[model samples]
Target: MTGFEFIAKAFKASYTDIAKRLNMTPSAIADWASGRRPIPKDKLPLVSKLFRIDEEYFKKKELTEVEKIKIEINYLERLSKRDTEQIPDTYTDDEGNQHETYFWYNPHEGELRYKYEELAYEELVLRIKRILTHDFALDMEYQRTRNHFHVVKELTELLDQDDGTVGIMEFEDISKEEAQRRRNLADRVNSISRMLYFLNGGKLHAFGKIDEFDEELFKLLRKFKIIDTKLPKKLKELDDPFDHRL
Candidate 1:
């Protein structure tokens, strides 16, 4: 069966239901079914996971006639939903504009700090390292070189906070020293973390050149099949959430 149809039927969800889950409309789902619209790469992972199908199946150029037949049979076994909800809209601010921000509760710090932006997975990791290094340096509780180890621990705690989720950061006007301190701390943390990763015998090539780090990391991840197949299993075995690396 075609990957999309197979998944829809297996979930026992209608096209409408599938659309709602993917933040698409029922007609959009139908377009996918009819091959009228191309499936967006960003959504493919989510669709594969939701439908419990191999991601590679959806990456194929086209389905064979036999595959189409299998898909139809699967669809026949399921019933359509009577109602469906629209997906929520995701928005971004205009250039040079500011927006309201919110933050998760920091029990240890005893404060709620506003977030900056909705950071991607890689960005989130870097930001966590940045925050931890600043916190450590400011407290004078850790040696400069030992910041990485401390960062990993602090990050684990911060991520476990109830409000921890995919989010952004917001900044306010601050002294030059404060901003410089924050940047310096973030840079050190990032450097140390990379060194630690290499020391652990993990492949450092995945990180690519340190200059274009984020894009390189994402590209390396896409080149390897490790993330979709292996990382999830590793994540499940880890007791500490932050111990799982991207």
Candidate 2:
């Protein structure tokens, strides 16, 4: 975990909550977590005080895998800045006319966002950093597991909301075919999760019923983590009807 993550965990707060307290954007917190941005000097004292730890606590820790990749990208950016390594600014268009253009590519999303103007060197560096750490190979698997976990969480809450007035139809937006597809996927995922849980000595699945699968389902959902595992846990604890579905 990063210092920012440790702080949020220790304080029982979300990134948005920490951002509000520190007067920074949530993306800034993500940058800190991703190691694209270091902790600001001005905020070190406050951070140390809040977490009841010394500044060196965060500094002395070994870099995580993500941070190591960020450091490599930063080093490569410096190397690419040499005078002999500059790229051209103009390209031949289909009309056979040379025109100025800039390109910024995000390998993770396979996207390029740019304007018909000069681009800042910082933009290229940022894109390279994203490309290096995107982990695209596992993106689909993670998203699929996350979707199943979401259904488990949402259905758990939905059971509590069925006071006989509201029907399940109110929350669905997809066609019946799509809904069946999702249901089949969810059943398969949930079955696999329960099997894993049973092997791991989790007793909640022994009950063998959907309504009784809450605790075991929560544990299984914990394994389907995304960028922030804590966020899902926090979302599960919320009581507001408007915020109950994850």
Per-prediction TM-score, please? 0.25, 0.24
Best candidate (score: TM-score): 1
**Which digits, one per residue and each the tens of the lDDT, describe model 1 over residues 67-155?**
43344333332222222233344345877555555443322121113112112223546665676657654755455546656656654
Residue 246 lDDT, candidate 1, scale 0-100:
41
Clash list (residue pairs), candidate 1: 115-169, 115-170, 116-168, 116-169, 116-170, 117-168, 117-169, 118-168
The lDDT of each candidate is 0.50, 0.48
Q: What lDDT score is found at residue 157 in candidate 1? A: 47
Q: What tens digits encode model 2's per-residue C-alpha lDDT throughout 1-246?
A: 665564454345677876787788999877775567788899877766654555764553354433433433433343344322333478998999998866543231110111100122223334445544554545677765665555445433422332342243335454575457446644654564555444445554355553535553554454553112232333356435474332
Error of 2 at 97 (Å): 99
lDDT for predicted candidate 2 compared with the true structure: 0.48
